[model samples]
Target: MVSPVTVVKCEGPKLVPFFKATCVYFVLWLPSSSPSWFSALIKCLPIFCLWVFLLAHGVNFLVSRCGAKRIFAGLIFSALGDAFLIWQEQGYFEYGLLMFAITHILYSSAFGMKPLDLKAGVVMGLISSFLYTLLYAYLSSPFTYLVGVYTALIAFMGWRAIAGVQLCNDLWTWTKLSACIGSLLFIVSDLTLAVNKFCFPVPYSRAIIMATYYAAQMLIALSAVECRDENEYKKKIKVT
Candidate 1:
């Protein structure tokens, strides 16, 4: 099992230029639905911003560990997924899907197989199975197999993230907590996207998708922060 997390000084994420650029779409400041380079850039700005921030954070502060590097790699793929997905109408859906699958694989690698919690596995499996069952009829040929594989990967990612919690160890650090929550949010965002794309169109689907996706990316990015241990933090508080 991976050791319980220890941090140096946990400073949270700083809002980024790319993240700020994406806000306009969510707020309907630019409501264009057309496919264009500018639109794709805006759609993917959040992930780009997070990647740069993670790199900077890792260099300037804590989280220079293996986990942070894997997370950084995942963000790179995630940004590519966003870019490819914006051109989904022009037939890049599968490529986008592939990129995200790699992203999750890297994320799961970062979380590691700690505590080997069956409870987390079961929960993730049931949810993934339910989603696949719901969309089975709509999936045809290769997409059927592809989506199934993607679901399993995501479930495993979720399982690994949850297992990192180590509730028994009483090591509920910000990194673990944010990573857990971020993984779940990533699942939720993907679930909504899959349902909307294959089953039926969700009203305001783009907004919903981008909102959850950005939030998930943000949290995962912040998970790279390394901070003082709980006792150490408390001790400093007492001193102050």
Candidate 2:
């Protein structure tokens, strides 16, 4: 049988690699980096890898610990959505949006699995509605409609999470909130892209938008790790 000391040492080794991977991914976002197709490709590489890493491990983690299958499914869909959004090929926006919508639906369902207060939903809805409306006013044509729908869906997911409050521990709560905020930043980044594509003649638009986009994806990955950690902790507690 493994002694407690041995278990602790094993845990330490696991954390070192996790932190190292995270740091490596985070450092790629520094400004002043040259813009090349290769650079852009590298920037998105971490998120794609992270998505795969988490989905493969996260499902097992959840199944053995929290038994939250829905959460696992949501994460898988969200990761796929992220992957779609990162694709740079022309005429793929609608397909990306469709995947993102599926992600929102899964996220919302996961959030709803937790018990929550009704008022949280109302508050989130109001805030999301106001923000999206203001944003939509500045966007052109069908892009505005597309973004409006996306915003509403994400807002609803966030509200559901807030209301359900499945993240019982403070750390988990923080992680969930960070992921939600990251998701919002991603939406902003995409909106910026749409503006640039359709209406704006702004300089450095790609840089600005990509900065936010990368940051958002990084934060979401961090949150996923945190959520997994929290679930693992709870499992240990239950076992003890």
Q: Give the TM-score comparing model 1 with the true structure, all chains together.
A: 0.85
Pairs that clash in candidate 1: 7-227, 10-227
Cα distance off (Å), candidate 1, residue 23: 1.7
lDDT computed for candidate 1: 0.78
lDDT (Cα, tens digit) per residue for candidate 2, span 136-228: 667776767887887778777666545533444533355566556666676667657756755556588867776776566554544444333
Q: Write the per-residue lDDT of candidate 1 for residues 1-240, one digit (tens) a residue.
A: 122332322232245465676676566534444767877777777777777776665474435487788888899899889888878878899999999999999999888787788987998899889989988999998899999999999989989888878777786666787889999999889989998989998998767777778888887877775553577644543543
Q: Show model 2 residue runs off by greater than 4 Å.
A: 1-44, 55-59, 62-89, 137-141, 164-184, 187-208, 211-215, 218-240
> Distance from true position, residue 62, model 1, in Å?
8.5
lDDT of each: 0.78, 0.57
Clashes of each: 2, 1
